[model samples]
Target: MSAPFVLLHPFAPFPLARRTRWLWLGVAALALLLIAAAGQWSARREASFQADSIHRAIEVHALALRGAAAKYSYLPFTVAQHPDVLAALAHPFDPAVLQRANHYIEEVNRRAGSDALYLIAPQGTTLVASNWNTPRSYVGQSYANRPYFSDALAGRNGQFYGVGQTTGEPGLFLSAPVRQGAEVVGVVTVKVSLQPIQEAWGFVRDPILLTDAHGIVFLGSVLPWLYQSRRAVAGSDLDWVLSHQQYGAHHSFALLPWKMDPAPDLPGFRVQTTIDGKPRQFLAVDEALPELGWTLTVMADYASVTRARERTWMLGLLCAGLLLLGGLYWQLRERRFAEQRDARRELEVRVRERTAELDEAHAFRKAMEDSLVVGMRARDLDGHIIYVNPALCAMTGYRADELLGRLPPYPYWHPDDVEQHWHNNDATMSGQAALSGFESRVRHRDGHDVLTMVYTARLIDAQGQHSGWMSTVVDITEQKRSALRQRQHEEQLQHAQRLASLGEMASTLAHELNQPLAALSNFASAAKAFAEQGRQELLVSSLDETAAQAQRAAEIVRRIRGFVRQRTAGQEDCVVGALVANVLALLQGEMRQQQARAVVRVPADLPKVRGDRVLLEQVLLNLVLNSLQAMQATPLERRVVEIDATVADGRLHIQVADHGPGIPAALAEQVFAPFFTTKPDGLGLGLNICRTIVESHRGRFTFADRVGGGTVFTLELEVSG
Candidate 1:
């Protein structure tokens, strides 16, 4: 009935047939052993071939990297020899020379396709940069701490790769010292981006990685693997990287979870790692780049070698089975046919089941997309909308059908931002859109404006080819409204604090006005008496004094009004001396009441600062008031408040010093904290409010203990040109 039974029954009647059966069994077992050996040999040969191929690929990758760096190796030297750069370095403070140098560097950088080019002074301050016109310009950044700068200062060419401290972008920096005769005058540096290399590597099938000597991946085909260390990095290496900020301080330098073992029959190593949540094996080949002290690695998948080995083993097993079982082939043909039919039926059933599963998965994904609160949209490479989730339609008050197949300048684009939208769309199509997302305004159907943040990602098709862009948009209108409300609340609090300060000084204000008003009254009465006696000269003198007193009283009132008035903040050029005088004038009565003397030493030639005049005055007044309060317990002779102002290094510095009990070291930091104070009656908001106002003007407020058992508070502000 079966192949095996018929073959054995024929031999059952003869002892010799039985012996032949045993011999055949032995031969079959021997054949299996030979087949396994042949399969092992094939697998080993394939592994060796793959390893050689990987080694070759790694060598090519190393060359490409070296070539990229070589292209810019001479740029820094050329720039250093240029006349403009030399002139800029010679007269680093000359604006005209700096401008010319900056323009020249910008042109050269643009033409050379470099990220940045700049000249550094001997002290390591950036003199001019190609991006000097941008907001994050490196015109005045200090690089004395960088190893490259130090190397160049030592009269040697320097090459290093690190994240830019100013731009926060990773790049290769090449520096050359500018020579004046035999002495190095300054350093010229060129920055080049290596992102193009990484992008090109993504097109290859194998994963390629470029690692620094410290084993940190600087560039890789796998984007997530970039900036990660191949192995555990600690001790001196970690310190060096952190101190130099080689990969940026933001990177944690986490180790990749990789297990490596020497290949049993290959020239390279075998690496086991997880990629996309699936375990994978790779044959790894590494090539050293001595020029840059880097390593180029290629990871070739081992699945192909495994499949080849399986095919070899299958072919061998088929031949052995044919030779050993040839007698039973005819008897087993019908049974084999039956097995094939059943296998086909089972495959069909699996296909149907898989189809059903795919349908369910599709439904699940659709439901998930529809349930998302964040709007989803996708567009093809041609910028034609291909898909829109229900959330997107609801957000724009448009039907799905209306949004689908739309192009640039769509109906939902804000009327005022149609051109911007088109430009953004073009950038997306060209693969230049910012990955961090951008904020934009969208128009609703009911004529309302909606603020949104849109993040875009590449859409990859089943074949792993980039097809288009997928965008996730979130409505940030409510968040923006909340932020605005918070700002308004803070402004109100600041205004209230100003009012409270005025309230506290009410008695001093009354006393201050009393003296001027009394003097005016006395002068007026004298003038009247002299007029009645026909003393013309005396009457004229008295009348002049009366007017002077009245003006003084009016000035005090005006200062108080300006300080108390609430209005929109304004920015203007304010003289530092004038600000100090106004603050002292406002606190004159308080100083007199406390039996304290005010010493003003402001320079007449100080440059004006750019900020809100009234806000700056409030800051000074608060400091003066605090100083006066601190001196309340000091001896009357030592109860003096000194106010001094100076201009240096393009900044204005003002100091208020008082000979009083100094703040305790423990309380010094707490002084600026809100609602923290030493005075029992104080609300503790004076220093905090003063600091806030100063910082709002792009200035700093700091305090330190004076040498003579007192406190010195300093305010630094940028001087207006």
Candidate 2:
């Protein structure tokens, strides 16, 4: 049978009457016992509240720490992904590239507030440092023994808390792998100062300790033994805090007075609370911060509770004494008891009010939990799924009960993204990080990597215990797909525009080829006539003409090929005169076909320009061909196409003019616009891409009405003389 629970009110009236005096004494005694119990309960409750507050404060500190880590993570990733950095690292120790990379690293470190950032070779040699003041120190050091650098070299991003090889001070090291696709090339390591953490999260004035999985103290404020002190007791402090306390794994208000000596082979610590230097009863709760792999032990003075109990006992004793002393005094005692009864009723009312407040807080928290965008889950270090929130269930399309024990490390990661997923997870799980947010692929319920923006926090159970992790994941699948589609469409548009330009130049090109062929035919006919006449000298002359004609035919073919070839495909060297002469020759046939003759204005001598001769010919052909078409229906006395060439402003400038109707002012500019041609059957891409090609070659193309009654197309090309 359980002992009967007793309730006592400080203001309850004491029952006293002739026959009820004994019963009243018994009632007063019961009240005294109940008051003692209540005092003890209140003390325990206050202690628990303090413990909970401490746990909450630790969480805030961890949040600050994680925020810093997430910031640090982006630095190395940015450096590794930068085009200049990639080009630099692609080569074998190019001094110029390395110097540029060093400068880049310095700039990044300055922005990120990092103490040290450097690149490590696969063999663990420091290739370059953002700050090279200690060159000889870390430049040749072996990072093979360091887990972060080694793991990164093995194609994984890794992090760890360890002593700096160069500074010989404790620090958090984060490393990201530089990969050429699947192969890891180098490691970029960033070292962060823990001092910022101390500033952000109030600590050191209180007992704060940070430990790792190996039980080694990574950080401790105001408690040297918690870190740096090479003592077993310092390392075992966490173990002791866990074993000796009945604190819940959450925030609690409790005071525990206990001690343990974790010194190697030494008597364990002995600790407990004292009141005025005397041993006093105490209560405590354990706060675990699993993310940091540590716990907090909170203690307070329990003597005040004892004193309160003693006071209540003293009051009861005096009341009994007074009641026994008088008949007249009994009336006064009765009045005092009546007052006590009223006070008790008021206390009950206050308790109800406090309970209501607690309920309100719970309701607000529930609302917030339901509205959060990201999924939340808790896991143990061994990768066991312990708990999950409803948001997480919704994200994965799984019921809450199904996700309870399911490990979801990379369920939604694209096959290509799995490796990166593991690397990031490893970094977070290790105390090397606090909180991290990134754009990564998560597996959706529909089996696609729901491109998501995830903000993950290292889970600390209670005090500073290193729980696995909890993340808020927002699906960005639509946005990602949209961006991808936009990029592909842009590429396709560019390709189509290129092809359209080529199609527009076809007519100009036919004229170019026909000119040389016509010359060859004329030369062949002359040779044949000479052969029939048996004129030896004339026959020799005709043979020379035939040879020249053959050369002309070859030149036209080469020019046409160059014009149509992809810009990056080939190279050709020719003088400015030769290129211009070739364009006129090709267009001669088209000019003839259109009954238009070209007036060439090229000088005898011109500086040679290096380029694809064929492409240059194509540019001139297009201009001259347009001049021919412009004059086709004109009633001018002479349908003339004027071709002019000169070197001006360090560039080759050529113009083609026709004696046809002058270009309309409004349509002159619009002619160059793509797909805006005035011709009935035109694709309107010729001049547009002609300008595009010219600009690509670092030149310009423009048009204006000719001086007389036609249009003029101007071409300027940067000369490599």
Candidate 3:
């Protein structure tokens, strides 16, 4: 057996136990002190980190707010320099001048995204406003008591924020004085909405507040805090706010129930407030917007710092407890080490097997890529070709070695399309490639062009990080050729249809030219008779009539020729009135024969539209002729076709309305279908062709029932600038 089992003690058991207990107590006390120190350190660290984060966020927010305001800063000054504004201020009672100024203000306000743009007279009367057309317009209103008006009248740039008296909307008002020589004539004020900035702040979890010089909150992420003062308002400040109507008449100007104190170990202040009937703490950071005389404050949750401190204390206690258990675990460490060695050996074997399987998978993927018919290529973010499969090499007739490591303007790009290829490459690199893929022409090694459709997607590495772009290219040469052939065939058919339409209009054309020619003959005969009788005055008058009739006949012939002439399609600025006149002239004989009257109501001031003149004429002619034909059954006195044109929202609208029976709703969908017709002898291509022409000109063709009893066909086209 081993040596005799004997126990030895350094001291008596009870005294030793007491000594050990005291030692543990002392150690525990020391541990408690250390834990407290660590908790304090953690609290400070967390507070500092939060303070820095809040400081950065507040800077961003302040910059954003400044940027929003700055973008509209020059607007007021720019408007002040406008001639219309000056004219309106000088002639405030002149409706024409005021109308022009109001329109200009409206356009500028819309384009600049300002809430209200208005001009104020020297006496503080609103002369013109962007909302002049609205019932709640600021025009004719007086703002003489407003400080911004006063400052501008004093010949200084003025800036103020307040609730609009007319709209009750809060906005920042920027004003500039309109001066003629040394005299201050008027003020140009621009009101910019701060709601967007407040909305952006609301996206964050922190409470953000924007306060004016009087410590009143003008804008805040928390809606209830807006217009609330940080301190009590009294004396002159309260009087000024009330007199100026700064926060509107109804605001009570109550103080926010919040208090601030210097944080113990942080760079910012500790703020305590009652929100929703519960107390909350925050670390508050302030940034001043000196230019606007405002302060931006961001408040972050302080409870997180407290939680971090408590967690630090708990973690320290856990470490001390772990140390106490360390001695108890020492005996089993060697056995655990032996067992871990065996486990590690088994894990190594499994890892080796997994490595082999991964290698096989990679090889299989490579083989699959190489066997694909569609070309595959991969590029890094910098646009250097990193990989190309064998199919890509065959498609471009270039070897992989020649394609790899290549930048844009690659050898496979068509020589004439290098710039286009570079543009596509840039778009792909910028992650703007279209999902439907793009078509490109690539050059083969043999100098032949190959049409290709390329689709690009972002390539991700194993860690799910974007590495580059992967492109799949398909050879669409044959497909494109087929489509081209089909388009050519369709164009031929359309040309034939146009010639057929002209053929059908031949009778109407002859009728239109007959009356003018007949009048010319009559005048010529009269002139001859007058000359033969030696009557000089009668001869001159007859000759003048003859010349006028001849000119009319020639015009009819010219219009007919222009209508039927075949030329390449082109676009130009065409006047709407002129288009309507020509269409009616072409169909004059038809209207007269059918006993139908034409009522044209085109605005003289309508802007020109950009389109092919002949094509537009054809569209109008077809519609008018159809109208004339449709109203054949109506009573002679009531049969009328109305052509109306107007300009709205930068677009030209032309409507052709008739007083005949309206088209049935069931047939509306089929009206524009090719080869679909309501007439027995009609080819059913007029409406279809008209729609095609309108759409090709980037205009819309639509029809709806008129208020009374007929169909109204509308053509909406963009106005030429």
Write candidate 3's Cα lDDT for 155-257 as tens digits.
9999998898888889999999999999999999999898878878878887999999899998998888888888988899988888999888655689887
Model 3 misplaced stretches (Cα beyond 4 Å):
1-149, 158-368, 379-386, 405-409, 417-440, 457-469, 476-501, 520-582, 599-620, 642-670, 690-721
**On a 0 to 100 scale, what is the lDDT of residue 29 in model 3?**
95
Among all windows of ten consecutive residues in candidate 2, which has the lowest summed lDDT?
246-255
Off by over 4 Å in 2: 1-25, 87-93, 134-137, 199-205, 228-328, 331-721
Task: State the C-alpha lDDT per candidate.
Answer: 0.88, 0.64, 0.88
Q: How far is candidate 3 from the true structure (C-alpha RMSD, Å)?
A: 10.2
Evaluated with TM-score, which candidate comes out highest? 3
* Candidate 1: stretches off by over 4 Å: 1-344, 532-534, 572-575, 600-610, 644-653, 665-669, 697-700, 716-721
**Model 3 — TM-score against the truth?**
0.56
Clashes of each: 0, 45, 0
Cα lDDT tens digits, model 1, 1-721, are: 5989988986777997678689878988898898888888888888888988887887777778888889999999999989999999888889999999999999999999889998899998999999999999999999887888989999999889999999899999999999999999999899988888887898998788889998998888978788888887899888888888787765478887789899875666888888788898999888888889888889899888887789889999999878757746754775488777868988899999999999999999999999999999999988889999988888899998888898877899999998889888888788888999988899999889999999999999999999999999999999999999988886776777778789878999998899989999899999989999999999999999998998999999998888888864589989888888888888888888999988889878788899998888888888888888888889999998899998778788999999989999888769889988777777778888889888988889999999987899999999884
